[model samples]
Target: MPPCNSTSHAVGGNTWELAVVWGVLYSDSAVVWGVLYSDSAVVWGVLYSDSAVVWGVLYSDSAVVWGVLYSDSAVVWGVLYSDSAI
Candidate 1:
């Protein structure tokens, strides 16, 4: 990982990954939700609470999903299974 610009951060958790590219702008409250990997490039963005999350340019090596939801909201995604999932 490279140096983060300002308060931006890159975090990984729960068998998922979240990476912020170098020079990406971030605020104190900005947080990386998570990332799912697949063969296609896919990125997901989710907003918790009423605060808005501003994400800069994001690139994925596989399929990515972007979602924004509120408290008590449920989201379901049907992704096609593939051999290259990681």
Candidate 2:
């Protein structure tokens, strides 16, 4: 794993989970996988479900998602789209 500029690691599920600042977190895992960004300052988590072999749930501070997303399946159901971010 490449060294992150600034981050805080929160271990869970046998993975090296990290909270990064102004950086990207990605992976090349298979099945039952996803990517997310949690702005620790705001206590918000954006869970993006996809298997594009590419980036997913793209956001630029907009409500309309602009990308080729396959599907969003949340194992932990009812992920709230907080109005503060949209």
Candidate 3:
């Protein structure tokens, strides 16, 4: 077994929040697994859509950082998008 190194980061918004963690590898196991890590991104919030209006369009641009795995480890994957309507 190898020693584990850990790291973490976090971010938040009016409608969402995200967090991530990573573990580094060491010792003999290093050659087998390379690096060790884990992370997660969560989004939770409330918003209101205008139901009383007709033909209303809401636009938004959004992005989030999430967890990825490589050799039994976790990494960060970020995504971006635009022209979102409610």
RMSD after Cα superposition, model 1 = 10.6
Candidates 1 and 3 compared: the better one by TM-score is 3
Deviation (Å) of 48 in candidate 1: 4.3
**Location of the lowest summed lDDT over 10 successive residues in candidate 3:** 52-61
Candidate 1 lDDT by residue in tens digits, 51-71: 443322233345543233333
lDDT per residue (tens digit) for residues 1-86 in model 2 = 34435555555745453555443345446433434443433222234424632323444333333333333343322222333445
Alpha carbon lDDT of residue 78, candidate 1?
Answer: 32
**Residue-pair clashes per candidate, as listed?**
8, 0, 2
Model 2 TM-score, 2 decimals: 0.24
Ranking by TM-score: 2, 3, 1
The window of 10 residues in a row where model 2 has the poorest summed lDDT is 74-83
What is residue 50's positional error in candidate 1, in angstroms? 6.0
lDDT at residue 13 of model 1 (Cα atoms): 36
C-alpha lDDT of all candidate models, in order: 0.34, 0.39, 0.31
**Cα miss at 55, model 1 (Å)?**
13
